[model samples]
Target: MIQVLRPARFTELTGEDEDIPRPPLSQTRTAQQSRRRKQKKQLERRWRHSAVVAALTPAQAAAVATTHADATSALDLLTFLSRERSHEYSPDTFATLALRLVEARRCPADVGRARVHMIRACRTPLEMTRAMDDLDTLARRGPRMDLMAYGALLVQLNTLGMIDVTRARQLRQASTVHPPILVFLATGLVGSQVRWGSGAPLPQGIDLFFLSHPILSTLASSDRLLPRSPAHARHLFDGMPRRKKRQSAPPVSIADRIGTLPDSLLHHVLSFLPVQAVVRTCVLARRWRHLWRSTTSLRIVGLDDNYYVDVEELRKFVDHFLILRERTDLDLVEIKFNEFCEEDQPYVKTWVRFALMCKVRRLTFHVRGSQYLYLDPHLVSRHLRTLDLDGVGLPETFLDFGSCPVLEDLKISHCIINACRILSHSLKHLSIYCCHNEFNCRIHVSTPCLVSLKLDHFIGRTPLLENMALLESADVYLSDYCKDVCLNYDSGVLCGSNNNACQNCVPIEDDCSRECVLLGGISNAKYLKLLPGSKTFVFTRDLKHCPTFIKLKTLLLNEYWCEAPDLDPLACILKNSPVLEKLTLQLFSEGPNHKVEIKGRYSSMERPSAISEHLNIVEVKCSVVDERILKVLKFLSALNICFIF
Candidate 1:
């Protein structure tokens, strides 16, 4: 029901006088005023939260934000939060909240509000059909959210001048009694005339708001006789740019309620789906045919999150996605393989490169099967800030971190690092869990800006760390798989016997050197936990030259620190830490059969200043009550400070 492009008198259309002046430009707060108010509100927010923030240490603050951002009250974080203390949540509000949310962006619920307004403005089916077409034309410009702010179009700010003149005429006619772009231009939106010009959808992200001010409405066409787009640019004005007229939009079904949604919103909804499913949407309607190609977020999984991905289909999709799609910024990209053969590693690597090439800010790569996706030197992205890798392999070259300059947090689990050195200048936090190496090389890490480090249950040689001046908290665990076994061959040779001495049967830290590597690097941490494996002696070896932990306030050690022979390691650390206040020991002691006593051993170990002066609390957890357990109780009794079991 495309309305004929003809002159329709406003007076005749709605039985009213045609002398009505163009509605005064809709007024709103200015950007500068809005900014000032926004700043003022921000200051107020800071003031309100300042006390709680001041009470938190940096580590606690980071933890709280990480753990609380997804709490129930954070639901409003996805959209503009209600500023009013007594805001009403009407029944209709629930409809908008029903939209699926991708982590980075949300499918706006208000997308159809303006369309509904247009429908309401229409007096008949003819007008309704014409209005729908006008919406198509309005969308020819990208589905820019600024235009769709709060579900309303910002017509006054349109530089393309491609208004729905047809709808404008209807609104003008309706306004005679009540109210209402293509000849129905979006005049009512910004209170400015939509100049007749090119149709190629407006470019995405166009908001030279200053240049497209409502004051530029003086350039509107004189009457309702719908004008075709201009031939070419003569002299350019603020109202019109030199864009060629876009072809008339594909016909939209007059009955389409959901199709009328802005593409930006639709794409957001589609982002929650894997690309395989996004491709299926093209068959739904003509408008959706090319929509999949423009989506900014990508999830390269099987058809769904519970993926049933086929290799050949994924291959075809990968090629189609990269080749057919227009270049755009990726907010978040994830590639998770539930199950795939080892041969697909190359394809997975290629997919990772594609995500990186799009400048993704957040990426998650998981190869969930027995296979691991080997990271390459080309894993670069200036925009990459957070990366989560599971079941992946890191090559020696990949550890340099020259690729991702802005990478801040990296969490790797169930992975293998075949690297000797791990260095990153921009990384703030690094966590590696259940990861191991192929050989006996001790990984060396030099991250001067690191704030938090966690190496839990990692295997292979104990890592040698340095240059961690900014470290605040560390949790290092030496699992049974760790190559730090010490079999005392003979006391005379320290860790060896005669020529055949192999007392140091495993990968123990070199005690021959005075430069403390592992313990010294993390000495600045305020909170430290060192959990050693049942027989691993890496902590003991490092204890020989452990650096003074000047900032330590809390420490947690394991049973090995007080093994029957000596409590020297515990004494050494306690002596080094001046401000230490709390100590916790978790023991899995053997029963009474093991000869354990502090009577002789405690006297041999010199008392650390922290124990006599600063130490306030001690906690001990035991596997069983035995002679060894009694010895630990004896030691706690001597501390005088209260002890918790």
Candidate 2:
């Protein structure tokens, strides 16, 4: 015992002292270890329990968990168990999870994850059907279900290629759901199959199944659902009451249903029909007698061979429409009168006066027959925002647009305007087409708010822009008489032809000779157009009087003679336009053989060295490319320029 225990191998230490002391375990430590093991086992069991419960009936627990704390704890337990173990969950449970996830605040990410899980869980058609049925149930329970979820389930069914249409019809019949939702589901299913290019034929007896659903039956009765055949139509109507059966019958003619619709829908439907059909419908019933008068739009054409409306009858129709229009407070009106006679001028004036009094927003007066149109200045509507007149003769004083203060758009086509003076402050858009008279064609526009102006004339002087501070766009196609028309600016005169040439040309006092003086040039316009004609305009140093057009971006020189004289006038413009971005020159090289030579008399005049820096792009459209034109290209290219033909 006194000797220390010698360190020895087991074989060598046979029968040696085995006297090693062992420490006893502490009670507190053993108790703590036992408690921790018990806690871990309990946690694991609770997690497994939650997973099984969630897999079986997620919706039941979801309905119970109203508080945020309860929902979060339940979700956390479910998530832990799902990650720890893989298990088969019921389709109803998955659907419930999808619904709960969607309803959670700020849970789009969770909802997306749940949707993927649910979609993956749908291995069989029955599972998919059950999921859809659960969603349908939830939709009926006052909870707002997502339309896209229904769409997804339908897509799954479609992918299977052969859906149990009978079962679907049965579910549709049993469920208390909206018809639109059911239609959406059905159409979505059909559409998805169509997308996959599948030949999945619709099931038989589907009609009978649909007929069992009240909503489907109602929709079928209303003719919203497709009828399989004429016989199907009869079958769909057979079960309806007599009153509903009569209501479901198709209308024989447009007149038959005109009075049945509410006024708003009736007017909308009538708006699509032609004026003759509208008139015929009006004669169908007493309810439709004054309905046309309340229409915001009206069109009457002489093409109808059956109706022979004389000037008096036309006047009476307009009077009746206007009287009813006043009673109903209609805003928009369009009248196309094909019957025009000298006797109808007073009647026309009366109608125009009534329209003005009613403050019609849109008024279109298209006179077909030959007649002298007299528009009294006092009768012109102040509230007329748009005025379009075509195919009539207007008085020389007709274009005195002083009364139309609120006029925003004005279009006159194939009509005569004796004096083209526009003095409206609110005039924004103006267009004149195919007017072949220039007796007093002096345009005096004082609109500070003018935005767009188009003038297409065969005989007239180019109108002057006296006060166009807000003028943004202008297109002018001048006739021979407008060759030397002058444009007066606040700063200087923009003469189209040489001022000295005007002295040699006949004076303005001579009616016939006054047309010879050509005036050109528009200053400070954003868009400018120069059209081709039988007019020779020379641009000398006086051409510098043209406006600088600091904001000019688009310039079009259309159908111009290719002579050097015409090109010389344009040089001054090209030099002055510093901010010009797009320049389009269209030349009519081949025309009536009025051989004119462009000697470039102003060739000796120095070209602006800074022009190449200012102009960015130039486009020339000509019938033939010649050497002189090549020289122009060379000149532009010499300045490191790019040209397009």
Candidate 3:
């Protein structure tokens, strides 16, 4: 919707620190083409971004305003999306740029349509044509359009003319915050919509056409502007600002009974909606016409968002929903494509081989960038069980999960790793977020009947979690770049804690780390989190070969495991967790709060057999609830351990 912004040079006109020194490094190509044609005609005759594009938005000042009476005399809205003629937004340029960013009280930018005029995020049918008033003649004057707001600029505001806006543009909503919720939300109109809970404020000149849109942005400047009586809406409903919590007294209308369910329970509730709302629920009838081809979940959200687009009718409705659905057996097929290039990789490998030839069983493929999906070496998934991926990349013949025999849950986010062993033996819940191992070796993860392991934020070489002894919940996060962390510390390399005077990490062999088995493959986990790091040393150099978790019970640690001033990796995981029970400890999370000096609180004479038999509960969030929280309550004898914070 931009109509002009020309800058072929002159450093693309306006600001972004480009160090001001280019006339192609000047050595006289005719004095650098006459000093770049006299600084491109003095920045095109001293530029004029019409008050910096209306001070950044009003739909970029109606895209360089061609004096809009509903725009479009386009003298080049920045080449209307450069280089190739793709300016195709018509429905009268999207209702004329949504009627000039919905007629003025500015909106358009980053919209979830401004949460339909926020009153603690209002919801429901409420879209009265993005409001400007005269709501279909005040919904035929019954309950005076009940505080007009079935949302969209308070519903239709008289097709954007705003019933002839008078002198409004002054000191507009100075310091926003509105919704003295239009006279206590009432009903009367449902088609253009209006079940919004009310509070008041529209006492006519139509309240200057609801202070010119963007959901009544705090209607100020009043001199009793118009509506002479009705006690100026009970004086803006006793000046509402949560006038007794939106003061509603009429919302009982529940008889829809899920439409007396049938059509296989409404095709199992339109198979948890999405493929464009289950093909717009076949216009909601004729038994939802084959109920979105026997909906067993196909959730396709082509997420390309910028605003007002088409994606070639979602690539011709996903090539006509892969030649019109009904090829049975799906249970889940989520797809999120955002421009997926390489000429759409053979139509996204024929839509992931038609969701693994319909024996789908949970598959979410999120793409946009870093795309790569070369599977099928042994992927004959016998009705696979959950495989979520994002960003993308995966090759070593899809990591020898030996033909997915009922593959058991795998999630990978922000991926890229081209395999070096993700050996799953009928995997059981594995999640790896922010993935990266393109190859710097050490990426082994033999999921030997794993049960819930989530390695978050990984980078290169620190995967190695070989055993999993039937783990039960692990959420590891090891990033201080993580190539076995201790990253070149004094270029030495023997990380046996801060005083082998701890050199960088990795090559320590018998003191463990032959690829430091990521916490000895979750040490038969019973819930662990091990999250934080500001240059982690893989669980403090795997505390020399510390493995007696003995089915640990809920530990969460951070301040990177008592980071070094000798707490001894939180006293070697509280003397190797002998039935530890809930011990949170996030520790000064967002820095600057000192006193970590618990100094083994007078040298631990007694107390660790999980703080004397089964550590009870210890919580601690912290940022500064200081005395270092009473020296971590005498350094973890935590006052008979129920010291939550």
Candidate 4:
């Protein structure tokens, strides 16, 4: 409550006393009215103080301290409480108010008024010392002075230096608290100590000490007793820029820090590190020993030292890790094992089943061995989105991913395709690389949603394709070895003398049937990259039954062998693809003697009358284009197509 000050008692309001002379009778009436007004205002302030004290709960005060834009008001409230209701505020309460006030700029009057409250908040010496220490630490870390103040200090130093017209002008500037000036002073002191020593003569009745030492001394004095050192001079060097090295922070265990975080957050952090590193965290402290069981993502890569060194140990660890996972849902489960023992097969199957049981979304396996690893069909999960299998063959029935509904991307590399059919409804991307077709393997696929398909170094009878209406792009490369059977065929003069042997010769119907099925499936592809590995068989094998690529826009022919007959397949593809826009010929030949001759645009058959309006760009990637290649270029130029070689 605000105490009304009497005329003679100044301390009642302002905390001071002053005597006032009494007014005459004429002024007495006005003085009486003024005293009554003061009393009424004091009474109103007392009631308001009571109401404010009742409303200002601890939570409300903290809220105001955090959200209030006017910090001066908060400081004033605390100051008023300190004066009227001093017992209500604790050390923590005042400390919080003081911090808020320090964080924002307050008026000089408000700061002075709050100073008393801040003092009262820390009633004990220890509390005040702790508060001061915290403030000092904050000040050391925060900016010593703002840019504006720094600029003003520089200006002051410049003005002071102008008074001295000697080299000592810099020394005069160094006496200021400017950081650069202080650095210069410290450097000068070091140099002085290195150059001068005790051999130097000493002056009478004068004392000196090293600037680095916290010692006080006088330059010279002849007073009755001993001379006193100047306080200002002693403090002048206190602003040296050399910061005292801070003590190293105390050692903190990883488990202690991790234990402080929520279990979910700790699991997420562990997920990014390798499984080995995650397991190693158990040694940090007792709290982290069981934390690995909470991780949701598991990536077991066998190529690393932590994985395949001991297959048995790795198997046991994985089994334990999976069994301990309390959560039912997992984000990713990846297992990449280059090689493992036959005896470890059961453990691998168990690991996969466990992952399926947990409803893992993405699964990958790279386990390789002599025989194909048979996976249980019942272990499939519908939540799977991506399934990548490398160096691991699949069973004939496992190719169809009906059990995995949401599977969108599939990859098979260096594996045997014993399956007769590969079908999926939700698949968008499919890649098969270096895959061998088993004996009697009749590969087929009917993925209507497939958008991108890549086939490289594929060996086998062509897979039957159906319902691939949405197929947009395809990269097909038949291996050179696959065409060895077709190359051995004797077409013109086939051993007429040995008529009986001629009957046993290879039949073309089987090869043509495979080509027909494969080409029919990818007929709607918009972009096709056909890398032919054989010079003659590729054209003779498939060109007869090649389907129309009405939507074909881009065609790439990677010709590694520049044989004269290699152009036949490319010519067939170009003639059939009417809408093809960009033609790229990737040529790689070692011999300069090799040359290609294109007598005409294509075979002697009459050229199609329909001019390809979209066929505008022709690109040839080869170092040397001989006369034969020039003839082909000239023919393309006649059609007004641009050539970029």
Candidate 5:
């Protein structure tokens, strides 16, 4: 049912063809010559990349020229150069170029017809095969592709989904000894799920765990990588050097490969993993199985005891773990047990002795139990620099640390202090929290090198200090128990560790005050933070009896329950600290039970007589500014001090 219509003659048709004259040959030849000249000029201009070539050294330049002739991609150019020019170009330069190519999708830097030809000819598999054949033909005329060249080719083919088992295996063989190259191939094969156990067997001497992601993840998760934006592969590549080629020697055995690493290096590598993860490396080979024994840093902490059906098995693991370690010096040994019976004490103490014999530098012990476990003071290492203990009992000779000669930091929390005197010449930092003193045991510090001290919720007679001239900072916090004791004025007097306070202590304002003992010890502190349990206990007539703070520069009264009776004590400290530079007053908040608003202004006031010439900053932290706060601000402003609320 189709119909066609044709015109009888061209002259008769509505649109007729008329003869048009052709241009002269002379003019056409001139136009063709002009176009040819422009094309030749552009081609000549692109024959050299001055800027890119200027930055390359002789070896790198040679590698660049080789890759330029072998491949048609900016990505492939850098990939081959990274391997061939590794000795000339730093790993960072290779990493940077590789990262740049990947990020920019490998668009060529060449500005000519060849850049467009490369883009069209190498993006697909069929076209790339022809290009590779051309490269192979050229390679045969010159030098064979190196291992790095093979790795680059494999990476490109695998990324384009054109790689097969046989080809990949062949490529892996060329780069078998180079772990960095192997890792690169492995990452490319990740999405493809290629396995060497299947079709084509991996070449001999290759690691059986070539496909594993653990080492890859470890290298990738380092601080120099991922969180820093995932392009910093230089650090990961820095550790990988070119493998030695020994064609005549026997095949590399497991013992000859991983065993060749230095003991220090193996130990350092193992330190990044926990004991359990470290133990798993033993299964890799016989040589690696025992390498965990040389690891100097050990951290044994977890709830495995509670999770396991048999706790004895966990204990056996811990014991075996300690027994297998070498007796070399240790950098750190931290053991925390959630709960242990009394029977486990001897076993634990034996392990402690083992660690001490190894000269542990940092030791942390945490044991949770009902009965207070006593730690033998003699087991402490003489080289111990830092010690932390929780939920334990200190022996009578705990402070007599003749063994720990270099101990610099000590932290004791929720423990019983049986020692009355803490004497050490090397101790610099001390912290005690929620500790109770035994009867007849009043804590005393005799460390001349102590620089920082923090005492929180300590129940004992005020601590005594001697030769603390170097103390730079001190923070003291009294517990709620002190508040209860102060409120119970009818109790007569505060009892000391010796029940003999009847003669040694004096009664002040219906309660016994040991403010002198506490204040007298920290007179040399440049920065002091004090949190009294109750206002009446410290804000007494004895406040004026304390010595002058010639070294005090900054004073912080935290959680101060400001009241009408607190001004005298505040003035007392200000009067004593003549050179105080900064004062911070943080008001206390009371819950529903003690909701007494501090709003009333003092009827009469007497400011500190000391000249606060150096007191330039006064900061008041509170929710609401009451009349009492305004009065204090007015008094401080009279001395030209800056107020910050």
Candidate 6:
């Protein structure tokens, strides 16, 4: 009786039985659970409904509906839909979807597919009618519609090859939407039979208008809307009546018509010609006499053996050019001379002075002289934002860019700067290439704003680059003869067992140790050039204490050796670079045989075991096909490489 008093019946279970009453359902919890279940059911229902609706499409509609929303999927779908009949879908839906697809970019495949679909989707007469309506809507909006977008649509329509005359006429008229429209139209017109006759041709001034418009000029030659026949097109252009001449025109002879062109247009045309041609054209007429002086940029490039020109003539030409530009601020001036004589020094100095006076924005001087020439420090350090000097000698007096203030870039190659303390507070870029001399040159750059520094062929035992807080990227190439080393010899800790100069010297205060990169051993040869040759070489290794470049992303190692000393240094670099993405190695050899030897060494070094762990992408280009090339391929393959040959 104690255990089996039957669980109380409903009548006996009233109110409170001995057993704890089941807890009353909490209203809040019950309501929340109900809501969640309801929401889930609604989602499932909606998804099912969408699937059913998609399955009801015609053959074309089915293809489009099944088209992957992504680029690849869209492309595949479009290709399939192109061959299908247009009667399979509602024209309105097709046009709407096509427009939407075209507007998206992530789905390039999809856009391409939609384009093909739109082209083939218009096979039906009804579809074509709908497309024309769509075009009309687009046209009515005028400038609201992007000219490029509209033109692209029209091009797609034309490419379908099924457009009727009326549609073609609409397409042709669309060209007037913008100047770029003309290019697409012109492209379509080529090998095309569409005609909008009896209508007056576009105004003759259109060509002149396009000449001044960057976008229009870019598309003028390939205008598909323009007539294809060059002669007919010329006639059409010429047929348009010219503006009436003023009765009171400036007093000018008919012989001067050649020079009567507007200075701006003349300059534009001349800009496309070679510098030599530009000089020759200056002799055309009085109006053209000062034309070359008006050039904003000048580049003097030497040809093969003809690169050598008479120094006197070159100096005279520069002198004349500078005098003519006395009043105007030259934007860019470049001078390349194969050789400079003592007599030419005065003229070169004058040119530099004038450039500084005019506040030249960009200046480049490449002069090859036997003896070092002293360049005025003041002229060398001017308002120049960009300066590139190659093979020019620097004065003994260290160049002090007393706050080049605005100098952003400085590049010097094959130049001798004897113990210069370069001080440019605003210098953002510094590149120096020293070849064939360990001139004991010490560069002390105190540029807090420097962002990039590149040093090549440095032979100094101690190269100092201090206090560049903003430095971000650096490219350094050391020579083999000069061990890559850094020293605090001021405190005196002589490094390298090979150097017995200070064997038992007391440690100096700033006794910084020199880090050397040795590349003489055969094991280190793998890291050396893939090709070998008796090419001119420079050896120096004084660049070791340069600041870390945290923002460096692309690194190009022109000629690198993988010696034991270089391993730890390179590892340190890789450890510091957290965002490096691309690495390119360029190798060159003096001769074919030398290239083979270098390539063989490169092959051995490029083995899978030799690749750095941090490398994500590697590109190796070897001029000669040898074992080195094969090794690189294998190395890259082990990493599942994306290689280009």
* Displacement of the residue 71 alpha carbon in candidate 5, Å: 58
Tens digits of per-residue lDDT for model 5, 138-180: 2323223334455555455555666553354343233222344
Q: What is the TM-score of each candidate against the true structure?
A: 0.53, 0.49, 0.27, 0.52, 0.52, 0.42
Supply every candidate's count of residue pairs whose N, Cα or C atoms clash at under 3 angstroms. 29, 10, 24, 1, 1, 23
Per residue, candidate 2 scores C-alpha lDDT tens digits across 27-61 of 46566456545544554555465533434333333
Off by over 4 Å in 6: 1-282, 289-306, 316-326, 380-382, 396-398, 435-441, 467-469, 481-561, 565-571, 576-615, 618-645
- Clashing pairs for model 5 are 282-289
The full ranking of all candidates by lDDT, starting with the best, is 1, 5, 4, 3, 2, 6
Best by TM-score: 1
- Which stretches in model 5 have alpha-carbon errors above 4 Å? 1-266, 285-287, 303-313, 377-380, 482-484, 488-515, 535-542, 559-566, 589-609, 638-645
lDDT of 1 by residue, 1-645 (tens): 222212232122212233422222343436534543454444445434544333433333223322332221122321212232222232122222222122222223233333333433444445444554554433332232222321233332122232343334422222111101211222322233234242322333222321232222223333333222332121223355669998997885587777889988998899899887888899988889988878978887776566545455576557546644655678888877656666766666767777786788889887676566677754667899999988888887877877678999988889889888888899999998898887566788878899999998887767778868889999987777776555552321224213553544433345222355468889999999887765666666577777788889888887767773455666777778877777777677434333322221112135542453566666565655777767767665664443334
User: How far off is model 5, as Cα RMSD?
Assistant: 24.2
Off by over 4 Å in 1: 1-272, 278-292, 303-313, 338-345, 487-514, 589-614
* Predictions in order: lDDT: 0.57, 0.53, 0.55, 0.56, 0.57, 0.48
Off by over 4 Å in 2: 1-262, 272-276, 282-290, 303-326, 393-398, 436-441, 481-522, 534-544, 559-562, 589-608, 612-614
Q: Compared with the true structure, what per-residue lDDT tens digits does model 3 show for residues 16-40?
A: 1344344455275578657545644
Estimate the overall C-alpha local distance difference test score of candidate 4: 0.56
Which 10-residue window of candidate 2 scores lowest in summed lDDT?
9-18
RMSD of each: 22.1, 26.4, 27.8, 25.6, 24.2, 28.9
* Better candidate by lDDT, 1 or 5: 1
Model 6: per-residue Cα lDDT over 1-645, one tens digit each: 111222222112111233423233455656745653564344334434453323323543334443434333223222333333223444454445555555542223333334334434565555665666664443332222244444445454445543344543543344324433445445344323323242434333332333433334444444443565545454545665889877874865567665778877776676554356677876776788878756656555443324655456566555444433314455666666666677777767766766665678898887665555557755454567998888766664535666466888889888767644667777888887773333543345566677777766655533455655565566555543332332322211224323543432222324223422211111111122211111211112222432343455555543332222323333444444445555555534333234332211112235453334445656554467655456444544554355544
Best by lDDT: 1
What value of lDDT does candidate 3 attain over all alpha carbons?
Answer: 0.55
